[model samples]
Target: MIELKSPGEIERMAVTGQFVGGLLGELSGVAAVGVNLMDLEHHARRRIKERGAESCYWDYAPSFGNGPFRHVLCLSVNDAVLHGLPHDYVLRDGDLLSIDMAVGIDGWVADSAVSVVVGTADPADLKLIEATEVALEAGIEAGRPGNRLGDISAAIGAVARRYGYKVNGEFGGHGLGRTMHEAPHIYNDGRPGRGMKLEPGLTIAIEPWFCATTDKIKFDNDGWTIRSADGSRTAHSEHTIAITETGPRVLTRRPEPGEGAASQIKQAAANS
Candidate 1:
């Protein structure tokens, strides 16, 4: 079910989102060459515990995913777009890594993901990463009230298609609130004005993932770690947002570009 949040509930979710936001920032800072994917998972588990929060991914078992993710965060590296199970993998120069994380605070869940180059970043890698960021931004720009979910999906698709990449529909963004995943599966491509209509308190995740080559994907033998079928590079970026009376509110906003607290959220207004 798609749950609409009360103003008070939105406030609680924002608090939870802020923690997720902070953790992504910390992880990006510490992720370097030679860093093991499992090490990041260890830190994520410990840090969430220190904050008195529970990890939504640790016990997550969605229909398409393997039983219980067994880790607090997903460490998806180059060619691996989503659900990358952490293992004894070591970082390498010019490798792109996408870290997807989620946590639950008082039963409310927030999900977010970030992609970055491991070390000695390559120009092509940098471009793909930037494209994902731009796609995510476009998706966010399309999340305003009075709009349909397709607007956001189209926005993201435009960016990926512009860069000559096809989307993997096998997995995409979804409604997020009391649970990590919820109603109204948001695809990477769709017709505008189609699907669900945006409404106040409607919270959802807008994640845009891209593969350098074809859209085909293959899950690793490990049962997770979705990678590009052709072994091309990949990048992912995402954010959870809420529809408000006036506009859209990005719950998982990070500190940047002079975005002030409470005011960082663009296209938003007082809830009705």
Candidate 2:
């Protein structure tokens, strides 16, 4: 069943989301060239422990995933798109990386992801990353009460198509609450005005991931990493949003106090 949060519960979710957003913002600042992928995982572990929270990815064992993910971070580098398992690999200049994380705080869960290039980014890479970020914002804008879930999907897909990127089929976003994943599967592409109706108190993760070439993907030997079939680079952007009587409220927004969109946009550009 699709779960809805009370106003009180939504406040609790926001608290959980603050930690999630803050972590991503901090991690992105240090995801530069020469950093080891394992170091990022350790950073995530320390942060989660320091906040008295638990990692949703570390013990996640979905049927589609390998048993017990065992890593605190999904460190997708270059062609690797999703569910990337951290290893002894060290990042190089110009490598595109995506970090997906989920944490449970005080019984609430918030999940988010961000993509960035290590150093000396390619123009194409920067564009691809920008497209996914724009798509995420578009999807969130369509996630207000009275709209259907498809509206959000359509908004996301439209941005991808506009950039000539193909949407991935296997995974997108999902409802989030006490658990990491929940009901109401949010597709990357769909017809607007269809699917579940968006109502107040509903919270869902809006993620848009796209490949530069084909939509097909293959699993890495680790049994967790997913890469593009044509070896094309991909980008992913995600945010947890709440459907309010007023509008959509982004629970996982990254900008700190006194920071504006210009700064956030600059952060995205710098990552590229």
lDDT of 2 by residue, 1-272 (tens): 99899999999989989899988887776777777787777767877898999999877888877578898889899999899998988889999999999998889999999999988999999999999999999999998888899999999999999999888767999999999999889999989999989999998999999888889999987789999899989888999988999999999988542344225434443464
Candidate 1 colliding pairs, count: 0
- Compared with the true structure, what per-residue lDDT tens digits does model 1 show for residues 24-143? 876776677777777777777777998899998877776676577788988998999898988888789888999999898998889999998987998888888898899998888888
Q: Residue 103 error for model 2, in Å?
A: 0.3
**Which sections of candidate 2 miss by over 4 Å?**
256-272
Off by over 4 Å in 1: 256-272
TM-score, structure 1 vs. true: 0.91
Clashes of each: 0, 0
Check candidate 1 and list the clashing pairs: none
All models: lDDT? 0.84, 0.88
Clashing pairs in 2: none
Report the number of the highest-lDDT candidate.
2
Positional deviation of 167 in candidate 1, in angstroms? 1.6
